[model samples]
Target: MLIHLAYTLTGDRRCAELQRMDSERLDMSGYAYYENIWGGGAESMFRRKASVVQHLDRLRVGEHSLFEIDDFIVNGGEGPGQQDEHRRLFAPAVDLNFRRFEQDRRAYLEGGAERQADEEAALMRWLPHCRRKLFFEWNAPELVNRLIPFLYLDTYLSLLRAERSTIEQVRRDLVLGLNRAFSHLYLTDSDNLYVTTQYLHSAEQPRPLVRLTIPLSGVDLFVDGRPDMAYDRERPDLLLRFAPPPALALRPGAPMPKLERWRLNLLTFEYLMRLAHGGTYNILADECELSVRALKDQLLSAFAYEPAEAGLIEFFVAERRRYVLKKIQIDEQGHLRSGG
Candidate 1:
């Protein structure tokens, strides 16, 4: 029935009787869930509108730009049964209706309805599917961030193969976008979580080595009823402290032998220095004779001595480029010079 109506509408059918019936049905049943969710009253409508507006503003976009009708309906999380009924009853003719509406808006300005009619015709031919509904409803920033990578993975891979951009740069951008979106939606009260990359090339493909750093003040980590030691805000050293379980004895000095500790510290220092100079993890692992897993475990454990403080140290170091770049200037001859 919907397909038939869509075909008719797209073909510019002048069936007033059919149009009136479809419009009435849509008004009565298709939007019933929206009314129910907003509570079929004036007050509820206002509240729903306000909530939507607030969410839109937080997304840093205008209301219409933030979401389409499909996004609104799908994110509402109505039951599957209701959705199926709606699709079966009215969805066939209204496939991509929101997109068509946008076209119609443009047509109204350009003095032509041809594009709008074409879109409506295309929608009619394309059967509305559950996946479309899913896309519409999952509108949260965090959700979009998480899904965008997967959605664009094929395009990204294609671009990588074409050598349009370096893999490392692409991975860095992906991590930054993911972290920014996550922070915006879930960590609203917390500062941005900076992501640093350590890229490693495998036999088959390259992988991103990711490090997440959140501000010490933004996180609360407690062990054995004691607050974790704070890191020096100005330093690059991360201090991580963890309480030993009752079964493990607490030692004041280093956990490993002195020789081993010294070796590990040297390795760690070299790795940190290389990372500061924009070195890749592949280079570090090769130089230090450490497996990726081993390096990550040791680095994470090293900070456990004073987790909170260490976190801040790492945070500052991770963001060092922002401040450090300004201090280093190049002469016309491309000689590097440092300012006091």
Candidate 2:
């Protein structure tokens, strides 16, 4: 769907870019060399392409609005009895600027600090544009719901990896910003749980920790009554603490190890995956504008961390880029509906 839409809307430029991508893939060890867990064989590709073409045809003939097309793509054309493992789980098109940012970030990551300035420059230029497009220009609320979380995550990662003395101040601002934004987007079941990445320490263990803390008075969510339990204990009902997985744990009194930025991202994502699976954080959809349940479903689908593989982290980092980019593009095109 994204390929067809890009080709249709952007014309020769998109076509040239696709051709160039194909050429680059061919120049690799082989086409398969460029493929990953998120990729499909020719048959599956053709099947998706065909379905998207049909949807595009409908749009061209005024049979459906861009929102309708977006609905079909994000939700799929399946009925209740037809549910399958391959069901659509929050697939949204991201914008061109984000697409390029991913490419540039990858290059910088692989090439080391030499390209850091370029990557940072690109993000500074595009973050506002992408935000504006998602918030104001785009009308696909479903897609936007699935996407903005990631935008926040990526922005957080960028700030974390930056070499600056004001990082703590910036991080606090990010957390507060998330609180302000998510307060409007999500509602809890008498449990105000606001989840985002934070860097803090535990008294019992002075290592990097992923803590979930809720500050309910009488509700002992942990049930164990262990004061050492560093779960969500701030103001939310459940506290989920995720530390560096055992394999990545650091030694005592060691200098702060420089983690690969995406590793931090994957750890945070893994924590969210656990939260989504537990079904403890109940988001009231009717009470809010965004379908956060759908967002969680998408998060579960996109970042399922268990049943791990060798390069799962790498695959997820790449897939995250594509998923966000697709959602942005879909939302941007929502301006096309004459009455919608």
CA lDDT of each prediction against the hidden true structure? 0.34, 0.32
Q: Which window of ten consecutive residues has the lowest lDDT sum in model 2?
A: 309-318
TM-score versus the correct structure, for each prediction: 0.22, 0.19
Candidate 1, superposed: residue stretches over 4 Å from native:
1-31, 38-42, 45-340
Hey, what RMSD does candidate 1 come out at? 19.6
Best by TM-score: 1
Kindly report which residue stretches of model 2 are placed more than 4 angstroms away from their true locations once superposed. Answer: 1-30, 42-162, 185-340
Instruction: Name the lDDT value of residue 98 in candidate 1.
Output: 36
Candidate 2 structure, TM-score to reference? 0.19
Model 1 scores a TM of: 0.22
| lDDT (Cα, tens digit) per residue for candidate 1, span 59-171 | 22112222433343333235786556445433323433434433433344454465667644543332223222333453344433332222343433333244434433433
lDDT of 2 by residue, 1-340 (tens): 4654344344323456657865664321112211211122344454354555443222122112245333333233356632231132211223332235445434544655876787667544534333333333345554444433332344344344552444434333323322322332222222222322222244542221112222222111111122334444532112222222232233355333231111223223323332333322333222221333343233233333332222111100114232110111112434422211
lDDT of predicted model 1: 0.34
